[model samples]
Target chain A: MWHVDEGTMNAYLDGELGDRGAGSGERGAAERGAGSGERGAETVWEVETHLASCAECRALLERVKRVRDRAGEILASSSPDDVVAPPFEEIQARAEARSTGSRVLQLSRIKRLAWAATVVLAVAVGWYARGTVFPTRTEQVSAPLAASELEESAQSQEPGAGSGEQIAASGEPGADSREQGAGSGERGAEQAEEGAATVVAAELDRAVAPADRDVAGRGAAAQTQTPAEAPSTEVGAAAPPQAKAEPDAEVKLRQEVVDVSAQRRRSDAGDRLAAAAAPQAVVQQVAADEPGVPVGGIAVGEALMFEDSLWIAASEDEAQDALGGDVPVIPDLPVIDYWTAPLHGGEMVRVRQRLDEENVLELIVSRVVSDVRAAVALRGIAAEPAENEAQIAAKGSLEAVAIRRGDLRVVLRGPVSTDSLRVLGEKVR
Target chain B: MPTDWAVVYRETYSDLVRFLHRKVWDIDRAQDLAQEVFVRALDVDAENPRAWLFTVANNLARDEARAAVRRKKHLVLLKGEAEARAAGHADPHAESVEERERTDAVKRALETLSDTDRTVLLLWDAGLNYGEIAEQSGLKKGAIGTTLSRARRRLVEAYERLEGGHVARG
Candidate 1:
């Protein structure tokens, strides 16, 4: 009989041999050591049978055990004595602080926007599975996601407030003369917990919303003639009245719902919710002329979208001809891009502009009959409440305001305070 | 599936600290690194959390070692250990001196190990099973036992030699 090697003998001494509660461990060892898990157990038994017959191997086992015991004794002596861990809360708090205020994170402006987006998604998933972990600390996000939070951190607005002012003040797109808008302040720590929750959703569910294909101005980069409709497989998942009460409810947007898992987030819902909550957390500054935020009162803001719309870029005249009327502009805001697309037997003219580097607004125009009002139904997170009848569909920090400009109706929506949306709606002429 | 981070944090924090303490030999520094490990971990849901914590702790300790060299902090490691141990003793002058000597001897023996040997031994002591050690240390499972045997023997011999040297000097 072949004698057992020290490695095998030592394995038996260490209980690493496949004799007890070692099936998987043995198999893992075989895959790692012998390229077959069976070998670990076979080797253990062989060593055992061999040691029983061979005095030499048995003698070696005694020597190995002595060494093992001595080593364990010495190693135990140096072990850190009675180490007490700080509460998990302390670590969580530190992570929040680091994510929000750390220099490295601050340098990545896009990352903050991404993290905010992540938090929205995470919160939706978390809430769906187990409801909100806790209520918002600051006036950031409300259960129905309060507009009062935006009042603290955003440019205040009354219904139909800033149209004339924004139009007169508007010079160019991205000018510093813009609304101190949504998602700009330091909502980092307050939202970091949510960011963690969504990481799973982001990784597991990759079916994505249609990527916005930019066709109007800025550069040739936006001018690329890619497919007008990118794959919108998962984006369609948001539809169903049932979603408001059901954890596994599908997201409802554009009045069409797809069978996307409710465990994942509705991208548009996340976009809107984060946009709604971002202003107070990332407050820019109050523009001197805009009104103060509405304290406890819910602001009734009108919103519109083209339901059966094929979103794309086209010229202003083409848009007007398609809609059988003239498209209006928000006077003071810089026009970043102008897009036109047919909707509900009419046409929609979209004016894309920036509030800041990260916060963007899309001012959309259509004939009143062809326009579908913005009805963002988030599944179970902040389901529709009775007082929220006229609530803008944007979930967190997103706000929408629609106003009638003569024959045309225009709606402005983005990650902004509803008050800001109201003020900008007043500027469209 | 989403990880219940609160449970994982509670279970693994102390083990992470113990593992880190052995690598850096500073309880406070170990605790700080352990906290950082959990902080990063909050953003992720790892399949094997204990293994993940150890892997991160190892990287942090390695970086700390490099940073210490750059700072040129030529700390008398033995003296630091003695002072640390003495600070906790009920009677500073009595058992602490002997405790410090024994600790210094054990630490010196551990230092004699090759990087692979020391890591394997420390990982085992830190509660990793053979499979976890193999996965984390990039060692074959069949080879772990051999490494452990060699590590144990070397540790005992080195400690015995240190004790003998002290006796001869006395």
Candidate 2:
């Protein structure tokens, strides 16, 4: 006298109630009724038995059948106009556009990255030299000239700033130099030996600018900083002649400064406060406020707090300026902050942060290069190749969304949905 | 081995577009999105192309929905202007007002169901059998029949309610 439930009755009507005889109750019910000629029949036998005596369930089945019929008719009646297939040509063009757009974006990203790295290294060299190279002369220069001419001087000397005295002078501020000179006058030789080692550490920053053609020369310059090297081989001797020979060096210096500043403009103004000068204040504040942790090979210096209020305060113009006229295609997001460092073979690592509506920070890590072979190389221990390279995959607890768009291999991480991550990944370039 | 992308595209394009058209309400957009699904598919090596297409198509539709929210006001203004243009001249559209009413009625009916139920019903309508619908919808195969039955019943009830209102107004 057991009657089938509504769900079972529905399954019975759809012929989906195949006999799951692993269940004892279902098996007993099937055994009590029709012998197993058909599995579907055996599964629905309980329902069939109830329907033979119960007009209520039979009427319900009839109603369900009618409803299903009407739904089918309505759906089928949709005009072909409502679902016209796009011409194959249009589809192909769209496909080509997607592929080409990604390629173009990647190429553009590589070029932009080169420009960005050039600017960063130029800025570091410029700022480092201003205090040490010609401290008194730099103070007398006009502000605009100070920014541009000083940068040119740095670039010219960049090839040969290898003397231990100049290295110690450049690494420390003007005040620190005077104090060290006064305090360590008796130990001048020992101080010079230590300064030589410090100069090598500063060369680490030089390695971050891959696009710079003088990488080999810079490496040579670093080696020349050894105290063992004769004072006669000081880079200052080579700087004056090189500056005189490269007249367009000033124009190049200005252009590099303009390009670098423009890219920095895409991020928040709070971050821009650090870019114009040595950001000694910002770096010091960050160091005091947040402890550094190593992620991958790089040390994440500070946790940039993502605030919804500040995010809303960001204007559209700044974003456009940062991207250098190519607007960030991602809607309602501004690049909050960014960091760039060099990778091997004329490639650079670019990290950008953007906040979602919920104020969760999404970090986009990209290698701006023409080839993503290095990016794919890191995927060796990944579970399996996804359907496509861009598809999101779970590697351990972290979900890594890797996209090889043009030359950029973008990996985005955050507490966002996969769809959001996908959109954000596409916008990295 | 996975089916050739060209073969999968040819076999599933129409059904996929139809399913998307119901979700998006614009044939051209649905078709464009359909092509995007295939373009994305070029990267995916799926065991079941049909299931993959539907899943990707669903995600694309969700993205479109988010974007549409930003354009809703602009669309409302365009709709008003179009209606004003239609009033000034005899409507030249091939379908009569009654046909538009019936189409809107079906849309409203489908809209009444919950997301899973509606998705199940639409996938079923798109010619995916119970097992296929289960894979696409992330529902169990055995439960798909129950889901379908419930969706069909609700859809009919909603349509009948709308029809009753139309008759009353007339």
Candidate 3:
């Protein structure tokens, strides 16, 4: 007969013994006999018979029972809780607060991005307006005066005359009269030329004339000469008394034209100076707006118009020079549209081009600097026609608000379905 | 539907806290960790709230035990001169609290016997018969008589040592 080992007894205590106990010889035989499938007197009798005959096993069983009882007594007396638990509501509140805090933090980040976009747009608009208005006025007032000066220099150099020599001493480029024949034959051209000459001659006659008699009376008789008539006939037609009356007026008129011409030249020079300075200012502004972005090239498309200024497209080299370095040149960017507006002190020209399949690139140039400052590209697919129409009709709906703020782009990419884009647009923006 | 954490907290807070406190000796740490366990339990499916709570509480106790071993190494390093100085500066009331904490540690160590020994002992103490013990513990009915006898001897040995060998066996 095989006896139950200490380890087997321990395994029994731990409840790990399964069918292996059935193979342990006589004890197993007795257990098998006791398996009556009934919790009755017969089973107890068999168990008692086995135990009463086995003195050593009975002593072992009694010892196990005593140890089991002692251990239980120790645990029962020393029960775990003398301490209390914290309020359950407090923990629930903390979890809820954490969830809400994270949501608030996400919303705040979105708000900051919106504010940044607003600031960028305002600055771009302001910069573009500044370029358009001032330069246009400067161009207008200056060009006519320069043209008049050229005409005066040409008239001063009549080849044969000492008066022309005297006028040539003024250092004007057209002071040598080499083309007197060209001035005479074409009737319409000659008439226009003669009209300008008459105005100049009358002014000269008035300057040499005496101050007391009326210069206005002499000037009225001189106006009767046909523009097609010879310059000598017009000069001879002027009344001597009228010519003698307005010497000071002639000098004043001559001085006024010269000063106007000179002022225009100065303005042109100022424009060039401003143009030279504009790129640096634009770069500085762009840098200030987007720190750490290295600027390589600034280019504008030919169709660009910002406010009243017209911007012609620039070549890669010109754009590189403007940007101060060679940038990743995207050549032949298709022109989408232009915006013309009066702003700042000149014309503002903004040229938009499609940078890629998804992005629209906008380049803004100021007429004053003729320099491009910002180049922003909007990225994402254009909304479907139906969606756009719905968006428009939804006007002031949540969907419209989201599209206006570019939230629709994020919604489109989110796990939410395409339809959810419309819903999110309506709800979140 | 989400498991209602409030209801779970109300129903099982005391029992779970007591269960954990028995496993982990520090009442405050056990209570804090028990709340964490409940919060984790709330994520489980609601149909088995008791089973989920038991599983989570068991996991938390096991994790705390591992952490305690790590803490013991660090404490032993500080316990030499630095701890002596710290203890010396502590108030008399604080000293008494430390003494009570040490006694608690001794009691907790006695509770961590093997599952079979613990169950067997607990069943016997509860006055279960050999047949009931076999049914509860899954031991063979024939083996329960022998297993209980040995478990009793081991408990007596442990108890005598705990009492400093002064208490005589009845």
Which prediction has the highest TM-score against the true structure?
Answer: 2
User: By DockQ, who's the top model here?
Assistant: 1
Rank list by TM-score: 2, 1, 3
Give the per-residue lDDT digits (tens) of candidate 2, residues A272-339: 32233223343334334322211221111111111111333224454333223333234446656543
Q: If both were scored by DockQ, which would come out higher, candidate 1 or candidate 3?
A: 1
Number of clashing residue pairs, candidate 1: 28
lDDT of each: 0.53, 0.50, 0.40
Query: Which model is ahead, 1 or 3, in terms of TM-score?
Result: 1
Among these predicted structures, which one has the highest lDDT?
1
- Local distance difference test, candidate 2: 0.50
Per-candidate DockQ vs. reference: 0.27, 0.25, 0.12
Residues A405-429 of candidate 3: C-alpha lDDT, one tens digit per residue: 2200111112112333333333321
Docking tier of model 3: it is incorrect
Clashes of each: 28, 1, 39
Per-model TM-score on C-alpha atoms: 0.42, 0.50, 0.32
What DockQ was computed for model 1? 0.27
Where in model 1 is the C-alpha error above 4 Å? A20-44, A102-429, B74-95
